[model samples]
Target: MSNAPVYDIDPATFWADPYPDLARMRAQTPVCFVPQLGATLITRRDDIFVNEKNVDVFSSDQPQGLMTVLMGQNMMRKDGDDHMHERRAIFPTVSPKTVKNVWKAQFEAATARALDRLAGQDRADLVKDFAMEVSAEALKSITGLTNMDWREMDRVSQGMIDGCSNYAGDPAVTAHCDDCTASIDRHISERMGALRSDPDLSLIAVQTQAGLDEAQMRANVKLAISGGQNEPRDAIAGAAWALLTHPQWLRAARAGDISWLQVFEEYARWISPIGMSPRRIARDHDLNGIALKAEDRLFFMFGSGNRDETVFARPDIFDPSQDIAPAISFGAGPHFCAGAWASRCLIAEVALPMLFERFTDIALVGDAPFGGWAFRGPLSVPVRLR
Candidate 1:
């Protein structure tokens, strides 16, 4: 084992604001091991972008990993052929063509319904009231869990996310995640009968038609809910907060000088919702002079990579006009987020513009403080909507 820098941090403080530590790591020891996290972090953009695709060395399959243990072995936990097979199966629901032809309208309707709910309110937390509602409603349609309440979708997603990230072995978090997975399994079972009789272009329906077993189906749905709900939810609210505070950009976007899609992309680059992805070293390897052993836990810090100084100009600032083509907010490997198109369409094409249009003037009541380095976004975007 090669000597790696032992970087110590107060987990609480790091969770609140990780950029400073990340930037420090990038400058000093980009491949240091954090004992608190029990994982080696790769902070540079180039390193992750290059190495992430090398799945032979940095594999995704980890049976003992938190996500696999807590949420079952979903495609995201698989590698190579296994991952691709699952990705292809679910592609019908999230493919760009499908998103444009089918889900976009559904997404618009969901956003509209969420906006209607906010019509009566003057002040509200966009995180819960608007963002969460819009994302959850659209997720229900996409996942074919229309029988499940929007709140229930959000609840289970959060539970699984917390459980997967529960590195401290919090039994309560693990138990909650177990409960969430159990609920998902029940929902999947309930919906399967109808889906077989009258199949549609939802994740569960498509995967079922593809002949995935019950365990796999449940895992995929749980995976979708885990990411599908929160990332877009956070992006919708986070991008709104970003553009609202940066009025010049918001005005430009509303005026059509800057595209809403551009704003979404930029905000995603700035504060990536799916921040760190955990990987297990599949074999002993040398990465940029740092020795990595087989089974050593590692994290590809997508958040830090998006803000790499060498790649992005003024990487810390959120600029819609800047070229974000290089950002790996959705990842760059075979395990890249399959719902990228759907998320973009939902947040940019539907949720953000519709919400702004519905309310004449939407302003922040106060600062909306953000939390979480792994899955980061505003805790509550308290805003006054007119």
Candidate 2:
């Protein structure tokens, strides 16, 4: 075992709010082993920013990791040329040009339709009612699984996400994840037949036309759904909660003092939707005076890094005035989120603006709750729509 300091934490407490413990870890031991997580956590901002790109030392190619085991080997679990190859294969669907020319209008229509549906309601759970609907519909267009309803898309995506993060080896979580992957496989199979006859620029269609085998196509699309559905879902709802709570900032944006893109960037920094990225220690090496062994589990704590006091002023506060260029919400490495541009377009350009425009008097109903550390977001944002 390495000589790194050991930090013990109550799993339940950490799950609810990891920032306090993460802050201590960053201040005391940047590289320490967390027994509960069964991985060495690198918690400092600069350390993760610099080391995440050092693929040779801290590698993403974890063959035995949970994501690969449950979700199959997606591009996120690969390194170097292998990762770029899969990324290029699906570029047609997620590329900035495609997102602008093709997806932008679709995202706008979806957001508008969702807003119309909620127009009659005076109160709603934004997470389930609004954010989930818009995120899933946009995702259906991107993944070419228009056959699956928005609810099923959200359900299966959450299942696979839970399965990937089931480090405790929960049998129920694993079983549900299996079912979700199976469901996704069936959807992909059904969609492939349609795409062959009438092709489109969706992830499944483009990958199939590019001659990627069935397994790769399934894995890659699953990968897209896993992050695509939840991250945007969370961000859309969470950002709304942030603005409603901080009316001053909301007023600034409404007055054109700040861009909605800035709000998204700041909120992403404050509470990262994708909080942690797990890695495997490819070879024996020392990181920040801590001895690490080959094949040992490691985690780049992006949530902690974003809140590192040395990097961002008022790191804990959700203030939009701060410079957010150092934020790694989309990650800072080879696996830097592939769907970032799409997410930005959906949430910042279409979802947030149109949402406030539709319901100008929107306000929180009671309390909006948040959970999870690995994948963090508002669990539910109860709001008064009228």
Candidate 3:
């Protein structure tokens, strides 16, 4: 409706403060064709996904932006039989039961160590000190890089995710992304080789034991890193910020004398790091009355969806007792974020306890500056603590 530069938008507007814009867009039209991205993005929760009948008109297999270059033919970017194959190979590693059993201890131990590091610190940037450290350790541990430096791992992973948002927008970014991808490939190949030769008690070993083809294993590792790297870590940091700011949520979460997982749902709703899932339609489609052609790029604004007035009461304000938290940060479709359960486990173990123990107080020191659009998160969370 308005001739605003929605496509070429700042990360802060969308990540730091996206509710108003999303409300304006969602209320006016759930699906409006954006010429810049050449696709209609569905903004409403109800009309967010196309039904089974119209599924053929809009396919998730056809990739866009950095995905086209990076994950051109990856399992997620493939359709039909190919997509199903990849999903099967990767599903066991990220399934909820697997995460709850196998990864939970490692995640909690890593979280405890990270929290100990900041036990008596006067003040700290949660993003730099706790969130990144905790997440990096858990992730590297899962990948069998137990001896890797957490900071170095953080640098590489954060660089890759942060680079994704600006890669297509700038020549320098595009070049840097090429370098990053090469490094990730090398790391994955080396790990794959290790799994191939000397088996260990790791997911890599599990994949190999499950009779995954060499190529499939390689692709699965890369896909796991790409989907679950900085995004989930940022979310962990965001979750801590939410708990610290809302003592009720933290107190309730810690008081497992009751149901705590419900509090996680609320905390996650407050600070969803992946504010939106960007996708490109594969064919011509009618999206909520809007005519969209093939290869149209759309952003499913999770930040907006979580706070939709039509969906939630008083969308802007945070509520720990929200009966429903409809956030699409993971995504919503056939390719709806395969690693959702593992990520939630990581956050549950890492962020919740750290907030409960270490920091007595956590508040926004100033205006929060967000990372790029693709990786939705605050770059820093300055807080005053005891």
The per-candidate count of clashes, in order, stands at 0, 0, 2
Which candidate, 1 or 3, has the higher TM-score? Answer: 1
> If both were scored by TM-score, which would come out higher, candidate 2 or candidate 3?
2
Deviation (Å) of 36 in candidate 2:
0.4
lDDT of 2 by residue, 119-166 (tens): 999899999999999999999999999999999999999999999999
Prediction 1 TM-score vs. true: 0.99
Task: Give the Cα error of residue 326 in candidate 2, in Å.
Answer: 0.8
Instruction: State the C-alpha lDDT per candidate.
Output: 0.92, 0.93, 0.63
Off by over 4 Å in 3: 1-16, 35-39, 50-55, 200-203, 210-216, 256-260, 325-327, 360-367, 371-373
In the range 155-270, model 1's lDDT, one tens digit per residue, is: 99999999989999999999999999999888888999999999999998999999998799889999999999999999999999999899999899989999999999999999
Candidate no. 3 TM-score: 0.85
**Model 3 residue 210 distance off true place after TM-score fit, in angstroms:** 4.1
Provide the clash count, candidate 2.
Answer: 0
lDDT of 3 by residue, 218-298 (tens): 555555666666776777666666666767766776776433455555655555566656556666665545556666666
Worst 10 residues of 2 by lDDT: 286-295
